[model samples]
Target: MIGLPAAGDGVVHAVFVALGIAAGIAVFAWEVRRRGLHDDRLWIIAGTCLAFGAIGSRVGTWWQQVDPSANDTLAQWWMDGNRSVLAGLVGAWIGVHVGKLITRYSPSTGDLFAPAVALAIGIGRIGCLLTELPGHPTGGDWGIILTPEHAAALGGPAGVGLHPTYLYEALFQIAAFAVLWRMRDRMRRPGELFVAYVAAYALFRFLVEFARANSTRNRNRA
Candidate 1:
């Protein structure tokens, strides 16, 4: 079956995204107050990062679900579906860079967004547990338990114990936040911190993907 085909009823993803951005804004405000980098322009930085992140994630998913090569009509493609997290991050990255061209924004802004995005993703992953068909399997030795029905909802084995990628991502995000917090004082450059953050996350996710049981991207698991 093609699953229930719903994007979670509670809008948890939306809420988490909002909260994560809010948290980032709060942190930015705090840093400005503390470091005396207080500038109205900082708000613009935060806005651009968060806005583009969302836009990127959405676009990536849209691209994945639409098989332009197979689907002929625009409406048919639109009605298809979306992609995975990897795709979303790619989308977010593309969106940020493109937005930079249009607005002439700086890459340094990524530093301000790093922590907030991490925090937001950690929380948002929780929502995925409650909504959407999770990438879980049938009974696990030490894994998540989704009903066969639920698994069917997400194209997975219902009632199996599958890898809790959401939890995995959440844990790594928390770790990323911790690392960023520790590096905050020593960070030499603005964009450097964010670059490190992204690199670290990519590595962490890739490592954890090794144990993932339901993914299709063997070449790039995470």
Candidate 2:
């Protein structure tokens, strides 16, 4: 039986997430330059999006942790917060529009951001794969089977194959990136590319959530 490794330290996950964010920002800057968008307001928009995205992600995770028994202090929650990618995306979208309204800069920047977001998500999911529970049972050999010790540490069932949900998401993001890259130039509308990417990702995420054991709706399983 193939064995999965134990979850890594929180610090490691944080480092990967930070790296992903930095890489995403770099990519966004590059794309902006390539498109000859020399708007000084772009940086302001990016900063706003980052700030709101962080807050939204943390809030979303905290909301999802609906366990009544888990009585964590506010400081503890802030220090070691869980985050949601979906929430971050939503927050970033809102931030971008709000920033634009504030700066009165009228241009479609979605095409520039779509690929960068996909790349960032793909990189960040690597950390999730390394540190979080895989997902629901796969009921097949073609999945990650965590060792007894590792499973115990993660409070998951041992000696069973589970879906590598994070890996699936990472692969999906990569594919989405490729598709967005190819379709960027073909999009007739300014924001169409980003809209299409977001729609595709939302559908993917919705289907994938069904295979998540930790999903709130799946908690009452036999």
TM-score for all models, in order of appearance? 0.74, 0.87
Q: Write the per-residue lDDT of candidate 2 for residues 44-136, one digit (tens) a residue.
A: 888888888777676545543467557466566556555678878888888888888889878888888899899888888877777677788
| Segments of candidate 2 deviating more than 4 angstroms | 1-3, 6-8, 61-76, 215-222
Q: Model 1: per-residue lDDT, tens digit, 1-222?
A: 122323344456557656766775677676667767656655554555555665445344443435567533545433433425565566556656665666675645666667766776777666564555445452445566656555544555554566666667888887888888777778877778779988988898787666565423211112
Off by over 4 Å in 1: 1-7, 64-80, 83-107, 136-140, 212-222
**lDDT by candidate, in order shown:** 0.59, 0.76
lDDT, residue 165, model 1: 68
Predicted structure with the largest lDDT when compared to the true one: 2
Q: In terms of TM-score, how similar is model 1 to the real structure? A: 0.74
Clash count of each predicted structure: 15, 0
